[model samples]
Target: MRTAVCSGSFDPITLGHLDIIRRTAACFEQVWVCVSPNAEKKNQMFTPEQKLLLVKAAVAEYPNVRAELWPGLLADYAMDHGACAIVRGVRNATDWDVERELARINADLHPGLDTMLLPAAAEYEHFSSSMVREMIRYGQPLEKYLPAAAVELVRKMRTELNREEA
Candidate 1:
């Protein structure tokens, strides 16, 4: 089976992220939508467990797609799972550069591992996890940004978190 790992922080999965995941799923026999746990990301709107739940809800329709949490080298995780490719979303030049460098590192870590970059759909090109968090913080409606299945959970979580802070 040709498997691919689509790893990201996914504090709250955005439409842009879903677009990339859907595209990747169509290409690979199985795709893992991994909620990457990055120590550098100190301020996360949602916990890793929450992100995993949201990702699971968002990708429920894709029979071949599974959502989970992973920390450390993404390529190594892929290898352990028998995945041959690391799929990522490239929304702009900055994202492209970062993914490109990571691709290089992944290749070095495992020579046969391939990296596939999918362009964000035009409508979701400007959407990002940070932007979604900002919208949630300001109490903006998420219908346009978040995947339909996860909108309610994200909104509810943000509201609950905000209440706790109050």
Candidate 2:
């Protein structure tokens, strides 16, 4: 089977992330939506477990797509999962540059691993998890940028965040 690993922090799974996951699922026999933790990233809005739950809910319709929590290097995760390629979503120039470099690094880490960059759908080109977190922090509606199943979880997290700050 041609398996692909799509790993990301997924602090909150936006529609943009779901778009990439769905496209990857269509292209590969199986796609693993990995919710990875970034020790360098200190601005996380959700826990890894929360992120995993959100991913599971978002990808429930795609039988071939499975969500996992990966704690090691992405290349290692891909190798462990028997993935032939890594699927990345590029939304703009910045994403392209970063992902391209990361892909190169992944290739270096695992000689035969391929990286596929999937462009974001035009409608979701402007959406991102960080932006959604900002919206939630300031009380903005998220229905348009996230799947219906995820909206509630985001709202609940936002409320908890508000309480924490209070």
Candidate 3:
């Protein structure tokens, strides 16, 4: 079976991320979303466990899709999870250039695994986790890029933060 893993920090998954996951899910026999916790990232709004929960909830409709937490090396996470390939999304030329090199190096190191870059949907080409956080921070509408549930969480969190400040 062709098992592919989609790994990302998924601070709060956006519709763009959802688009890639759904599209890739149709192609692979099974698709696993690995919530990668980036220790180097300090501005995270949600914990890794929270990210995993959100991913699991978002992907519950797809029986062929499963969500899990990945805390270490990405290639190792893919291999350990029985993923024959890693499905990555590219939003622009720069993203492709960077991801392409990483893919080549990952293949060389893993030998048995491969990486596939899925182009972002037209509307989602500019959607990003950092952008989502910024939107939430600035109180901009984000229904187009995120689901209602995620927006609600952002709203609640923002309100609570405001209360704390007050």
Candidate 4:
């Protein structure tokens, strides 16, 4: 069976991420929502487990979709997981540039793997996990940018952050 790894930090697994996953699922036999473990976000708000939990909850209905965490080189992880393709979501020119570079490196590292970039849906074309976090941090509603489960998680996280602040 063809498998694609749609990996990302998934800090909170926003609606934009789901949009890509749902669309990409149609093209691949199986899609793994890999919870990317990046050193840059080591001290992140959400732990990898938390991120995986969120992703699992969000994709519970999709029998072909599974969520897991992987730390280190993405290409290496995809190879280990038997993913023949990497599904990425691109929102703009900058994302295109970044994904292109990543694709080049991944392809060089794993000759058998391919990378596919899907542009974000029009309504959520501008949405991002970071943007969703920023909006929630500033007390802005993100009903459109986040799923219902994510909305609850964001609210809980906000309360926790407020408690820590106070």
Q: Find the candidate with the highest TM-score and give its number.
A: 1
TM-score for candidate 3, residues paired by index: 0.89
The C-alpha local distance difference test score for the whole of candidate 2 amounts to 0.91
Please report how far candidate 3 places residue 45 from its true position, in Å.
1.9
Candidate 1 per-residue C-alpha lDDT over 18-135 given as tens digits, one digit per residue, 9 for 90 to 100? 9999999999999988788888876687888999999999999999999888876788799988999999988899999999998999999999999988888999999988888888
What count of clashes does model 1 give? Answer: 0
Question: Which numbered prediction scores highest in lDDT against the true structure?
Answer: 2
Model 4 misses residue 134 by how many Å? 1.6
Candidate 2 deviant stretches above 4 angstroms: 160-166
Residue 122 shift from truth in candidate 3, angstroms = 0.8
Q: How many backbone clashes does candidate 4 have?
A: 0
Alpha-carbon RMSD, each predicted model: 1.2, 1.5, 1.9, 1.9
Candidate 3 per-residue lDDT over residues 1-166, each given as its tens digit: 8899998899889998888899989999999898988787779987777777778877878889998887777889888878899999999999999889989888987998899999999989989998888887888897976765567666776688789889
Q: Give stretches of model 4 more than 4 Å off.
A: 41-43
lDDT of 2 by residue, 59-85 (tens): 999999999998899999999999999
Residue-pair clashes per candidate: 0, 0, 0, 0
Residue 123, model 2: Cα distance from true site in angstroms: 1.0
Residue 144 miss distance in model 3 (angstroms): 1.1
Q: How close is candidate 1 to the true structure, as a TM-score?
A: 0.95
